[model samples]
Target: MPVRYLIVDDEEPGRINLRLALADYPDWQLVAECDGNAAARAALARHDVDVIFLDVQMPGETGLVLARELACLCEPPLIVFVTAFSAHAVDAFEVHALDYLLKPLDDTRLAHAVERAAAMLRQRQREAYGAALRDYAVAGAAPYPERIGVRSVGRIEQVVVDEILWMEAAGNYVELHLPARTVLHRITLNRLEALLDPARFLRVHRGAIVRRDQIASLATGGEGSHRLALRCGGVVPVSGSYLAALKAAMAF
Candidate 1:
């Protein structure tokens, strides 16, 4: 019943210090260490980690952004914020972080946070955390992600959600269609759909998801088949099952 955890910090020294401190806890095991939010997400995709010691600040995307994405996940890991700035405390707690620890870590505070995390996990209180995350989003404390990270050529690329006109299934991956180009994102259409804001995106077919604003017109063909023309001059099919939902979303 060991607690598997990942440490996410931009600074190597900070990661090292936290690793050394966590070594004192016999029941805790270090699953992996990541330099930033993107690496952490990649690690999470590969491993079933129980907790994440997340640093609030990073170069490209902040830890809070990652936390917001994680909350949308089916089963998110427990988050413990570790940072130098105390100013992010309120935001951290709003995301239902297990604990927030300031940098230049204090032994007593670290131990307490570790204990609290272990207790919560043992009690199987993750559902409560998930509920709080939903409530946080509903309360407008956190919004659906504006950008999504996709691993590409040994680096993570940030895809602006608003720029995507539609999404098509590409084997195990999803192709994000933009106005001028298409970006391949390594995620399933269903999973990616779950992460997006439902109010703005709609599933027109089993293999297609289109932004609401991009829909120009819906065309019907022989045998009940239908297709939608996008404002960007792109077309996507519409399955009969989703037609009603699409019509409702389009207010037609």
Candidate 2:
């Protein structure tokens, strides 16, 4: 499939330079061009674009503003900022742009950005197709997930569920305690716990969840309080509100 492109720059010369640079690539198709952010958003709604070659310093609505809005979208296209100023490179990437290109259009950098965008787009397409195939094969049946996809600063990592010994609630994030290391995942503890298998995992406290097999011993605390020691030598407290469920699970 051809890669669709949307160009957004205030100057006509900048747009023309990008078009000339991309014309050498057979797989690239220019879907639309807009002078500003509003026009760009309209063009985006009208076309399925793979990459946006945007100018950072535009009059009125800036490219950074549009990029930030796109970043919050469920499926944002790859963004490559085209600008004369090198000072805005950090700001452009902070908005999750795939690449930043200095103006007067270096042919080498333009080619590299388009290639990177194409590769990323192809990967996302393949993953989406694979998911659709799995859903069709299941025929609406639900299967437990073995791994969770974690989106971090600049990349996504797949974590094995079985390797997780316990999980704790952090402010606006969940910490997954694994054997070798702990990962601060940007997901709520309650949401992550729901994805886990109920039989194999248990919510021992309001703020903590533990793998069933990882529980090594249940220790006593003051005033009839209880705490759980894990096979990994880590200990977690069993709140009074959850003590009954813990007792039931232990057959006490």
Instruction: Choose the strongest candidate by TM-score.
Output: 1
Write the residue-wise lDDT of candidate 2 on 144-251 in tens digits.
556554544434455677898998998767788999999887666766665568988999887899988887788897898789999998899899887777777777
Best by lDDT: 1
Off by over 4 Å in 1: 91-97, 137-252
Model 2 clashing residue pairs (backbone):
none
Deviation of model 2 at 185, angstroms: 19
Off by over 4 Å in 2: 91-97, 125-252
Worst 10 residues of 2 by lDDT: 131-140
Model 2 compared with the native: what TM-score? 0.50
Q: Backbone clashes in each candidate structure, one number apiece?
A: 0, 0
| True-vs-predicted CA distance for residue 145, candidate 1, Å | 19
- The whole-model C-alpha lDDT of candidate 2 against the native structure comes to 0.72
